[model samples]
Target: MANSPSSKKRARQAERRTEVNKARRSRIRTFLRKVEEAITGGDQAAAAEALKSAQPEVMRGVTKGVLHKNTASRKISRLSSRVKAMGA
Candidate 1:
């Protein structure tokens, strides 16, 4: 219960931020899933393209504070490696 007016305002702000962050996280997951589906489906070109599109969305998540920088980098690295391996 937020008794103070300022605290109530903060609570409202937090609720809004939580919804926004949740949507951002879901969007990032969707992008990652697209890449994974492409990779698993054995479409190298589609996988490469999906990875290309996902990289920016993942980085955007990091920039927006929904994901850590290292986490985003690691994900990008692993996906790119898998995409590359598909070519070989």
Candidate 2:
């Protein structure tokens, strides 16, 4: 219960931010899932392309504060390595 007017305003702002962050997180997951599917499907080219597209989305999640920078970097690193390994 937000009794103070300022606190109420903050609560409203938080609700809006929550919706935006949720959408961003969902979009990032969708991109990641696409990369995973491509990789698992064993199409090297498609997986590489998916990873290329997912990299920026993952980084955007970091910038938007939904994901940690290190977490995003690690995910990108692992996915890239997998994509690279698929070529071998």
Candidate 3:
């Protein structure tokens, strides 16, 4: 389908980028899931710690364009709030 040399190169590059982005997104989700499990298990301290580590990873995703800034911020906000509620 990509007959021109430049187009062919672009297609290859796109494939590589897709794989990288998929891995990055999956990694971010794993961090988020850890926080969620900690919260759901009612371990406030663990949830707090998990959120501490996950926040930066989520933000890193935003910086890398894997997620939007607002989405990352909302996720961090919701997770922290849940952690706080667990404390109370």
- Candidate 1 error regions (>4 Å): none
Tell me how candidate 3 scores on lDDT.
0.94
1 or 2, which is superior by lDDT?
1
Q: Residue pairs in steric clash, candidate 1?
A: none
Cα-based TM-score, every candidate: 0.98, 0.98, 0.97
- Per-candidate clashes come to 0, 0, 0
Which clashing pairs does model 3 show?
Answer: none
Candidate 2 residue pairs in backbone clash? none
Superposed Cα deviation of residue 43, candidate 3 (Å)? 0.4
Off by over 4 Å in 3: none
lDDT by residue for model 1 over 1-88, one digit each (tens)?
9999999999999999999999999999999999999999999999999999999999999989999999999999999999999989
RMSD of every prediction: 0.5, 0.5, 0.6
What would the C-alpha RMSD of candidate 3 be, to one decimal place? Answer: 0.6
**Candidate 2 least-lDDT 10 residues:** 47-56
